[model samples]
Target: MSLGEDGPGTRTRMPEQHAGGTGRRTQPQPRRALVTVVGVVVLLIAALAFANRGGKSDGSAAADGTSGTKAGGAKGSSAASATAPTGQRPVTSKTAGIPAGFAHSVQGAQSAAANYAVALGGVDMFNAGRRHEIVATVYAPSVSAALQSTLDRAYSADAEKALGLTSDGTAPAGLTFVSRTVPVGAKVTASAPDAVSVDVWCTALSGLAGQGSTKPVSSSWFTVSEKLVWTAGDWKIQSSTQKQGPAPVNGDDQAATADEISGAVQQYGGFTYAR
Candidate 1:
């Protein structure tokens, strides 16, 4: 299967693997469509964001449904005094496996979006059940219902097959699927008591791991922008969008083997990110 920018929707015939010895690099071109799909989910987040933001005036808190707070937590905005980290853990609890109960401050909102991005851009997203759980956990309740169905279609079976996965989203036997997002930093674009928008610069690793794997895990850089709402004592993602990144020049370090990369992924557990 070949990959394309449309993500899971694009499919082509899979090329036959060449006869090779152990640890051969004679693999076929990887289907980067999987990578594109990984990034596109953020677009779904943005769609939901607009839905959540609809009907709210863009002005002060006095404006119906708007929170009056300026950027950087200025005196007039509840976000004022919140420009810096509170040094406090953003949440004391978890909801359906997602962090919950964020502080009602700008810092907390940024932290929530950063962490949510990591969760959204993860391996679980390829798996239907887990994907639903993550969405419900991080997205506002008001939008998750519709978002779930939307995402289901977005990550369709055709897309999975393109990436060498089974229609059920499982990696081929003996191959490990890889999808992860690491946040480099976050900046609040806008902040208010009820709404906050943050952009998180991040790098994502995706593809697969296995001997003779065509897609031997690769990395890409992207930025995720999230609009969050203070809801039910936590910051829930309302919308999100993504763009190709602010990537730096390549490093001089030598690339590792497929086995080594696979080992590292298994050995290193992901963290609960904070801004």
Candidate 2:
């Protein structure tokens, strides 16, 4: 998955740890590929800036019907092996122009990626300062500033209310906000002395409103291809993109209650994904 650009306020909600929101995925459904070609534009909300959020525009591109680890070949897009990683780290240092360092192993990249994904998908994205910090922390320098400003406005106070969030995105009373990102796997796409690109397939828990909603926080699988630059011993996003999925058969596991959804989100802390 390689992203062209990120637009703030692109959707009506932000993800909670398990925020009962994200739409459901039934792998048995037919595929009518819907490729959302988002323009290179960033929105600065004239009003309710932080209120803005993003979601899949109905059905998105299906690996248009490809299998896990095998889809990249269909499109002639190079990707790393899909075999499970041997979570390890490199020896002394891995360099990228400026003073550089990277974890010597795939596990390290996974850990970093998972944590970055959580941060990227978390409720914190609504706050101005936090938005800047997160974009700066996860993204490469080349793309941070613009993303920060756009996100700052996109996650405005107005954006919050729409998703049933406080101006800062917290659950009310006994209700807990559910927002989470679970990494399914990671693969190296292209690695260089200064940068690396990894694709992370994941399940994102999001949504709001009532007990029964079209967008229930059901599991979904999508790949996030990140191009990271080695900076100060850490990986940062240069750019990223996402596509529908090599999603597996939907499970028969019964969905949880909203409260259970909230509880599960609170109980499970996401991982730092890698490959």
Q: Identify the candidate with maximal lDDT.
A: 1
Q: Candidate 2 regions off by >4 Å?
A: 1-101, 104-111, 209-216
Which tens-of-lDDT digit does each residue in 1-275 have in candidate 2? 22211111101112222321121234211111221113322212112312223223212121210121121333323333334324233223312111124363333443455456556665556556655666666666666776665554455566566555667655444444444456665555444445555566666666542455333455556665555666665667666555557677877888777767755666654432333
- Residue 85 of model 1 has an lDDT of 36
Q: 37-127, model 1: which lDDT tens digit per residue? A: 3223334422111222212212233100123235554433223222333345435466656666766766567667767877776666767
* Cα shift from native, residue 123, model 1 (Å): 1.0
* 159 Cα displacement, candidate 2 (Å): 2.1
TM-score of each: 0.71, 0.62
Q: Once all C-alphas are superposed, what RMSD does model 2 give against the true structure?
A: 10.5
